[model samples]
Target: MTVAVGAPFRTVRELWPIAWPVILSGLVALFINGNDAFLLVGSSDKVLASAVAASAVQFVAAMVVTGLVGSSQVLISRAIGSGRRDRAARRADAGLWLGMWGGTGAGVLLVFAGPVLLWLLSGPAIDGDFARAYLTVTVAALPFVGLGSALRARLAGLAQARGLLFASIAAAAVDVAVAVVLNHMIGPFGVAIGTVAGSIANALVLAWFAVRRLPAPTGVRAPRATAVFGVSRGDLRDLLALGWPEAILYGASSGAAVVVAWLLSDGPAADLAASRILELTTSSIAWIVLTGIGTAATTLLGRSLGGGDLPAFRRILRHTLIVTLSVAAGIVVLGLLLYIPILGLFAPSSVREASVPVVWLAFAQVPLMALHVPVTAAVRAMKDTRTPMIASLIAEYAVFLPLGWVLTRVIVLGLTGVFIAHVVFWVVSVLIVGIRLIGRIRTPHTLV
Candidate 1:
């Protein structure tokens, strides 16, 4: 369990024992999410636009929640790595407290912000109403989704991949069942509701396990939430240090995509649909490498560094990079090979032609984007989130959005241009993260 800084085991060899299960779980989760998205806008361009619009508000809520929830993973991973079981237990309790308040706050904010956000994202007349309805229902579920995030992060940091996987599979099945049934019955709104129900269910499952399996408080001690975990200045600082940047990066990325979507709103329906589908697929693959393996890397790296195993940490980093690169290449190949069929799943025949080109373009960029996960995760493992945040802002705001707007709106390359913009964005982000990681590697001291 105690690995040196330069542990001989390859990162893949080490990480696979933990990461593959997480990835499998993530795929199931991503598929459910993507399916819900597809259900909302499979046929109508306007509905698709609305779905994106609604998702914008949800994204903001997620960022805010993540700012709080993210702390749990870093702290818990450190505790676990150092074999501080009690501390890990305490942190898990803290995560629950954070989830309740943070999720509630985010939910309230979303309920109020939903209308304002929708209005801001409004395009043509038809799309506005659909967007409003979808956004409303989804945003209504903010508390559940936000809490779910906190729970998931805690479990992940504990290396409870199996539990997480089970929860995800259960959630996905329920969500899908509900979505299919409701989509037939109540239309797009039903799908959104079903998705929310799934999130709620997922949170419950995670909470149940965390409460039951973690160490119990002695009779002399107070309740877990009241006695063990409370918001503290230190906790806030630690959480904010890593979490804010991640939240900001995610918010910016999602926001940028929405902006680009708006820019090309007037393009052909097929093209727009294709762009959405591409985004969905890209997001799916991203979770597999970035979010999935990244979660594992973050936990492993955080733990190793916490235990003063700098060499082991570095080994983990190396292995993560190797695995990420392999996965990225795999995504590219899979993307290219499955282009027509994958796009077909989300688009009708009428839009298939235009969708194909945009999707292919998006697939071409998967490898670059894939490379970004390990670097970001590794840096986060070092508990230095500011660097990644600064890098993301520069890459996304300074480079990606501007170029996307130009290519898609001004230059009018339509979906294809949008795809190119995404590629450029990922390529730039990967480089930025890579450079930062190298700096960390060269530093004399190990960061925990």
Candidate 2:
């Protein structure tokens, strides 16, 4: 899973290989999630309402380990760039150990604490009982999601992202098939169980390939790769240092959706439904697609920096930014054009009225998102996740939520105000993150 980072990919051909698989995989993963909506279309608004909460809940909880294990990608890429495959192996080992244990703990906490957590996160957006049932059944998926993230990080670092795509396809297929079968037998909870099944399938497939293709290090002189938890304290610390901010960043993003639901709870039910549907669909597309681009940026920049190739990093960043912005623009246009039709297909008949008007705000976010996703990725690649995390906190708490509260609650502008605030949050975030990214790019390797 280690490849030397020599020259930057100079041609469009080289760039396509890194970007396409990750993008396709993101799309495939979306299909797995898309099942919750597509299959449950006939369900009531209460069940439909659970969609946002369930999605946010899984992401928020899973993000804890996902962010930590994600450090494996950073560390592994750097090691490969510097021609230290053994170090990459250690990083991968650390990721797996932490992902397993951390994922388990998160799952246990969420399952046991389901009622309270769902109460806060779901707000009045979803039926409390339905949310709990969904959350409880999907508890087992958390660990698999964590491990799958770790495995994905390694393949991404090694630039073998096609493996990740294969996993995603398998996961999506399993999810759809199981969901269909179980829905007939068991009713609404089928989708939740199917989600869990997909997670396991994804992790298992990734593990199978990893074991056979990415062999264990031999004739190596690091401590046995198996300590009590399979990695050394140093590697653990390294992961935490890089990962905590990623956790915070992702958690904040996920938690923001829940917060939005809470804000919309007191308003007209249609508004909340519209917002949630937009979040699960339109907004999800922007974030997911940008995430694929961000992955490419991370791998290229992480490896380039590790190899002490500043020029390569610069070029890679530029290429990433151009492609991300271009793709995001296309996504925004297509999403806007197809919003009503897509919503009609994906959501029940109840949501169309409130959704059509506010969906523009969701689409408006793509430009800002296109800006920050790669800029922040570049910052993270430089091993300074704190800056982006701090920026997100400032934007989310200081600006986004507070401004949203005022616009919606104090001013009574409803969903209009909420989406406006959402757009503004990214504007503020892009400025903050861009400044840090530029600084790090100029300095190279210096955390400051």
Candidate 3:
């Protein structure tokens, strides 16, 4: 069954059509999530301040869950590809249980240790107090985020992208509406509570759908917090075996971002502000391209691996590279054309003076950023998690951080240098990871 490149329904083409909606849905969600900050900036100064603090806490919580429970995407995606529906169900159960325990642990730590965490990071006593209040409310909402991410990954693994997209859109709409009304009525604290409430609503909707869509067994009671979700011991072991490396990969990447943030925080006000602006822009685009391609890659490559078709798996990898390049070029061109307008949306006056170059430099790497996602994702699909983790770790620490340090500290380019460093980092990342992925695809493995 050799599929032609121009075939109408080939796996590669099929993923493209599905991926566009998923990517667009994710971008809309990001925009909606940022709505509170956007809308409240003009309301009251206090409301604006609170929105900033709360958004930080919410993002930190999201990063924690995203780095940890995101492994479910790879685990469940591979399980479905293997045609092990029973095992897939069990993996979902284990993931749910894991998310619960992980969320509980993090929530407890935030309750007890959050103040100290904020104090250490805030750079001043007054700032620490504000950060603490925000962290308090946001931490209280962690379980919902954790649970929702796990369920969403399960749904994605099932290839029910439309359902996931719809639920996400609904959730985003409710979040923005509720946050806006509350921000005007009850002030910034109201906005924070409204945001949490919205996430709770999203979780409830997804939980209902997940329960309905998931397979049921005759006599099994849902497992306890430790063992609940109907996951067996064997399934738990397998998921961890596959998921831990992916978790570390995400954690390392996020941790690097935080370090870079801290480094920039010590610079001049313009430098700090410029770095933050660059981050927001890069993050917005990165989530769309990386996350969409990663999900699509896991599904397609996992299926090929499960069907024992190495050639098919190889073809998917090559197609992913081609798709990445195409998307990357489009993003770069868009960035170049809209640099002034897009940067103006965030910091109109200062953008041209300080942030535009950084933003555009980050944009220039969109293709390289695209290369990173699908390649790493294909490795996960092949159950070769160690390779990606190792490669990403090397790229982040040995390549990204070191060069960024020199560019920002030693070089005279300031913010521009930081942006240049970002591009260089991604270029190096693509080369290293891309080569490794190519090697894996070329060397076939037998699954006896």
Q: On a 0 to 1 TM-score scale, where does candidate 2 land against the true structure?
A: 0.91
lDDT of each: 0.70, 0.78, 0.64
Flag regions of model 3 displaced more than 4 Å: 1-4, 7-9, 36-61, 124-126, 185-187, 213-230, 268-274, 345-348, 410-413, 446-448
Give the top-scoring candidate (TM-score).
2
Flag clash pairs in model 3. 223-228
Best by lDDT: 2
Which 10 residues in a row give candidate 2 its minimum summed lDDT? 216-225
Sort all candidates by lDDT, best to worst.
2, 1, 3
**How much does each candidate deviate from the true structure in C-alpha RMSD?**
3.6, 4.3, 4.0
**Per-residue lDDT over 261-379 for candidate 1, one digit per residue giving the tens place of the 0 to 100 score:** 56666665556555656666764566565567778888888989889998778777777776777777777777678778766664678567766656666666766756788788788
| TM-score of each predicted structure versus truth | 0.90, 0.91, 0.85
Tens digits of lDDT, candidate 3, 231-302: 577876776776667666765665554445444544544554445445556646665766686688777777
**How would you encode candidate 2's per-residue C-alpha lDDT over 184-236 as one tens digit per residue?**
99988888899999999999888776766545432222223253266788988
What residue runs in model 1 are displaced by over 4 Å at the alpha carbon?
Answer: 1-10, 214-233
Off by over 4 Å in 2: 1-11, 121-125, 214-228, 444-448
TM-score of predicted structure 1: 0.90
